[model samples]
Target: MSRGKTASALDLPRPDTLDAGKQQGAYEALRGAILNRQLPAGSRLPSTRSLAERWLVSRGTLEAAFDRLHSEGYVQRVAGSGTRVCAVIPEQFIAAPLAREIPRRPVAPDQPDAGVQSHVPFVARRPDASLFDLKTWARCISRGLLTVGPGVLEAAHPAGLPELRAQIADYLRSYRGMQCEADEVIVTTGIRHALDLIARSVLKPGDTACVEDPGYLPARRLFALAGAHIHAIPVTADGLDTAQLPEAARLAYVTPAHQAPLGMTLSVSRRLALLDWAARADAWVVEDDYDSEYNYNTAPLAALKSLDSGDRVIYCGSFNKNLFPGLRVGFMVVPNVLRRSMLRTLQLTGHSVGASDQLGLVEFLRSGAFVRHLRASRQAYQARRDALLECLGGHCTVSGQQAGLHFVLWLPPGVEEGDFCSRAAAVGLTLQPLGKFCHALALPPAVIIGYTALTLAQIRFHGRALAQLL
Candidate 1:
C-alpha cells in the first residue's frame, strides 16, 4: 500500500485489494485516482517499468491496466510521450450517481455509463445556441436599459417584473391558448424554481404526489426531496393514465404539451379526464409547459390549464428553450385565489428573479423580437427533427416525433438501453437511455435522441454510425 519513491503520484492498488485479480484491481485503483483527482487530469503516468517495479508485478500487468484505461478513454498515449490522464474527462465518468435504484428493476435509459464521455457526439437535450442572434438580443438589452424606467432600480416584486408578467400572460394566451391575467403570473427562474415554489407551498411531507412514470427525473427527485410520497403514474400514448392515478395524491406533475422523453401530446380527452381527476381528488395539477412552442406535424394543443374550469391547474411556462437557456426566466399562472399565497411564499423564501434580466425580457417580448426569434428557431428545429427522424426511423422504431426537441428511439431487440448506451459511447456516440426516466415502474428499452442542438449533417453522420451499432 505504501508509495514507492520512484512511483508517480497516482495511487497504486494495495496488494491486499488485488485479491479480485490484478487487472480489475489495477483498473479500479487507477479509475478512482483519476476520478477523485488524486491523479489530476493530464498528469503523466509513471514509466511502465517503474510502475511495474513499484507494484512488484511484471511490466505486462501494468500494460494490461494501461490498455484498459486507454480503450475506455480514461487516458491517452502520445506518439513520443508516455500515457497521461485525459485532458477532458468524459461526461459518463462525471454523471451524478444514481440517487436510488428500485430493487430488481432492469437497466433504465438515462443512466450515465461510467467511463463513457464526450469523445461521443452531441447527445444532450440542450438547445442549439448557434441560431441565436446575439446582435438583436444585445439591442433588446440596450433598449431595456434605455427604456426601462428608474422604477426598475427599486426593489421589485418577488414574483417578477409587472411588465414581463404582462408580456408572458399575453404570449401564453396567444400561443399556448391559456386564459390568464398579469396578476396570476408569478415569474420565477425556470421549471425547477416554479416546481420548487409549488412543492414548498403545497406539498406536505408524506402526502402522495403523482408523477408521470418515465417522466422528468429532476422533477421526481425534487418531489422526493420535499418529502412527498411519489406516486408514479404510467404514461401511455395518450399521456398520464388518469385511471391509474392514486386517490390520495394531492399534487400531479405533467408535461402535457409534449411529454418529456416521450413526445406525445396529452390527448384532449385525457387532458380533460386528468383535470376532472384532479378536481375529484382535490389535487393540484402542475402543468409543465416546458417545450410547447415547437409543434411540427399538427397544430399545438390547448394547454391543460386552458381546460381548468375548477381552477385546479397551476400552469408553468419557460423561455429557456425557446429564447436562451441562460435567461433563467419562466412564469407560472396560478389560480387567482392562490396568487397571494404564492407571492407571499416567494417573498418569504427570497426566490427573486433578477430585475435587469426581467426588464430586458420585458423588452424582448414587447418589441416583437421574441416572436421573431421563435419563428426562426421553430423552423430550424423542425428541419433538424425531420432530418434526425429520416436518418434514424428506418434503423429503429421512433416515437414521440410529433413535437419537442427530443424523441424516443426503441432499442433493437435483445439490446437493453444501458448496454446499448455504453456501446454507443465507446464508438463516439452519446446515447440517453429511457430507463433513467422510470422510477418504480418499467418502460420499453429505448434511447432519447435530441435533434435541436445538432445540425442535419451531424445527425446524418452520427445516425449512420448508430444504425451500424444496432
Candidate 2:
C-alpha cells in the first residue's frame, strides 16, 4: 500500500526511525491516536504482524507497544479478542488544574468563619474544654467498651444503641418534660447532623420551610440544600412571629427555648400558637434546644416538645454544648408519625453515632455524674456571667443574658456593627455581629458575646476592655 493509504487506514503516523527505538515511537503514535479519538474507544487494533509490516518495524516492537498501552489502561487485550482501545480512558477522568475563576455557589453571609475552635475571647457558642471531667469520662468510656458484644460486631442499630436510647429517654422525661420512649429517640452526631437527617427524611424540592429571621444559619443552609424555598419569619421579643408563618410551609425550624442571637424564650401563648399553626399547615416543626441547660435566674423552661400535644414537634438537643463539643453525640425526640421514616432514612444513609460514645453517654447519664457536672458548669458560668455584667455596668445595653452561652450587646446609635467587630478583633478580641445572623430582616446594630469559654478574670478584663472601646 502507498504511504498515504497506510496512514489513512491506521489513522496514525508511521514510526519515524526504527533506530531511535521503534517501540517508543510506535507507542507514542498509537497513544496520540487514541487520545485524539482517531482510534475511538472499543475499536480493534490491527494484528501485530500486519501493523509491523505496514510501519516497517519488527512485530516485537508492535507487541511491546500494545503491552505498554494495556498496562497503562489505555487499551484492553484478550487472547481470543485481540487488542482494543479501553472503553473508558484513564486520563479522561483526571480533575482539571485549579483556576481562579471556577464557578462556586454563594455562601450565606452569616456563615461562621474559620478558626471557630480557636480560644478567642467573646467567641460565641464555645464551651470551656478545661472544665471537662476527663478522669470520670475516661472511666465511663472503659465501662462503655465492655458493653459492646458480638451482636454489634457486624452492624450497629441505625437509630442508636438501645441502652443509650433508653437512658436519653429517661433524661428527657425528667429534665426537659418530654414524653418519649427509647424507640422515638434517634441518635445523631450533633444538632446539625440531626437537622440534616430530618431534612433528608421529610423535605422535598420546592417545599416551603419557615426559619427565624435571625435564626440558626446552618439550619437555613441545610433546608436550602434540600431545595426548599426558605421563608425567614420575623422574630419579636416573644420569639418567632407566629402570625407570619406561611400556611403552605412543610417545615418550621425554631430555637424556641432560647432564641439564637436574640435570646428570648417563646411565650406560652406563642408556643401553643406555633403548634396550632403546624397542625393547621400540616407541617413538621424542628425544635433546636441547643443550650437551654444554663438558665441563670429561673429554672429552665420545659421544652417545646413537652407542649407538643399535636405531635408536630421534633425536639433536638446535643451533648456538644452541655458536656463537650468533641463528644459529638446528639438525639432527636421525633413524633411517632416520623419514627419509621427517620429510621428508614438512617438505615438508607448508613449513619449511626459511634456505639462506644453512645454507650459512654449512657454510663454518664446513669452514674448521677452528669447531673453533678451540670451543677458545677452552671455555677462556673453564672459567676463568669455576673463578673462580665458587673464590668460592663451600663456601658451598653445587653439582652439575652437570662439564658444560654451567649448574649447580645446592642450597639449605641453611632456605633456600626461591622466596625465594632473589626475594632474588637484589632485588640485580639473575637466577636460575632448580630447582622451576621439576620437573613432578610434589618435590625439595630449589635454583637453576640459569649462568656462560657472564658474564666471570670478573662471575662472581667475583656468586658472592661469592651466597655472602654464602646
Provide the TM-score for each candidate, comma-separated: 0.73, 0.75
Output the lDDT of residue 361, model 2: 85
Question: Which residues of candidate 1, in runs, are more than 4 Å off?
Answer: 1-122
How big is the positional error of residue 97 in model 1, measured in Å on the Cα after superposition? 42
Which window of ten consecutive residues has the lowest lDDT sum in model 2?
Answer: 2-11
lDDT of 1 by residue, 15-107 (tens): 555576877777777777788887888898886787777777778887898899999899997655778899877756678667798588686
Clashes in each model (backbone N, CA, C under 3 Å)?
Answer: 6, 0
TM-score of 1: 0.73
What is the lDDT for 203 in model 2?
Answer: 98
- Tens-place lDDT per residue, model 2, 115-180, is 444256888466787888999998997887876664664665888888888999999999999888
